[model samples]
Target: MLEVTGLHVAYGGIQAVRSITFHVNEGETVALIGANGAGKTTTLKAISRVVNAVGGDVHFCGEKIIGVAPHEIIRKGIALVPEGRGVFPRLSVLENLRMGAFVRDDKAGIAADIDRMYAYFPRLKERADQLAGTLSGGEQQMLAIGRALMSRPKMLLLDEPSMGLAPIMVQKIFEVIRNVAAAGMTILLIEQNAKLALESSQRAYVMESGEITLNGESAALLHDPKVKAAYLGE
Candidate 1:
């Protein structure tokens, strides 16, 4: 449902992302896996319009979004759960979740969605009144994902959902991710955790030095020697 073609992004004379082309089919998860500085996050930023693309185009649901304003992105049915789990520190968990549906006016639907989020992450319901900044890393990650889903997005952009968390916590987060994907959420995941990314996604792309180095079925890439050596560490 999303297509990025010849995408290029440069900042401060450093090319963060080179011309890269990829697509995410509707209702499938596509992972972009790489190490630090691989331009994984930049590619998401460009697609989400958080950062400008110097060249190429981003089409979501067949409409160009490259020149679209950042605030307008949510209205187009795309939500980005950015890296580092950007949450409203000063706001309570409940307040933060309410903010997610800021673009909408349907109170009944928003209320129902809040209950749905609480069901998705029961911990969020427990910490309903707690300040977001005080939640643990995993909790904040859950909050981020829940908040994004409040918009009822057609596609979700996830950047490093596994970063800075305990192994058990990562497992918990991925469980939720699996649930979301199973329910037919279209996800374009950018992850430093290659193994998790591959296992979670249906198709995968290996990015290196700001370009796509390999692309194929996730299961095949899991067994590919080059992918194993460079990313899987096998």
Candidate 2:
């Protein structure tokens, strides 16, 4: 449902992504795996229009989206749960979730989605009135994903959803990711934890120095010698 071709991004002469191409089909979970400076996040930001691409094109569901505004992109059924979980610190959990539906006017649907989110994340329901900043890392990540889901997006962009959480939390987060995809939401995931990412996604891409170096089925990539040695610590 999403296509990116020859995508390039630069930070005033420092090119972060150079001619990378990839696609995520409908209802698929595609993982972008790479090291810290491999420009994985840059690629996502470019797709989300948070950063401008200097070259190439990005299309979502057959329409060009390279120059569109970020909010416009979100309204077109794409939402990004950024690397830092970018939640509103002072807002209550319920309030944070309501922000996700800011672009929508369906009060009934929004309320129903909120209930669904609470069901999907029971911990969030328990802390529904608590300040987002006070939640634990795992809970905050849950809130972040929950908030994004409140927008009723067709595709979700997740950047390091497991980043700072304990192992159990990481597992739980991946489980939620898997469930989300199973429920028919397309996902383009950027993850540093190769093992978890590969396990959760159907297909995976290995990125380096702002380009795609490898692409294959997740299981195949997981067993590949180079991918295992470089990213999986095998």
- Tens-place lDDT digits, model 1, residues 72-179: 999999999999999999999999999999988999999999999998899999999999999999999999999999988899999999999999999988998999
lDDT of each: 0.95, 0.94
- In angstroms, the error of model 1 at 191 is 0.6
User: Where does candidate 1 stray beyond 4 Å?
Assistant: none
lDDT of 2 at 27: 95
Model 2 TM-score is 0.98
Write one digit per residue (lDDT tens) for candidate 2, span 129-177: 9999999999999999999998899999999998999999888888888
Candidate 1: worst-modelled 10 consecutive residues by lDDT? 225-234
Could you tell me which 10 consecutive residues in candidate 2 have the lowest summed lDDT?
A: 169-178
Query: How many residue pairs of model 1 clash at the backbone?
Result: 0
Model 1 root mean square deviation, Cα atoms: 0.7
Error of model 2, residue 156, in angstroms:
0.1
**Candidate 2 displacement at residue 136 in angstroms:** 1.2
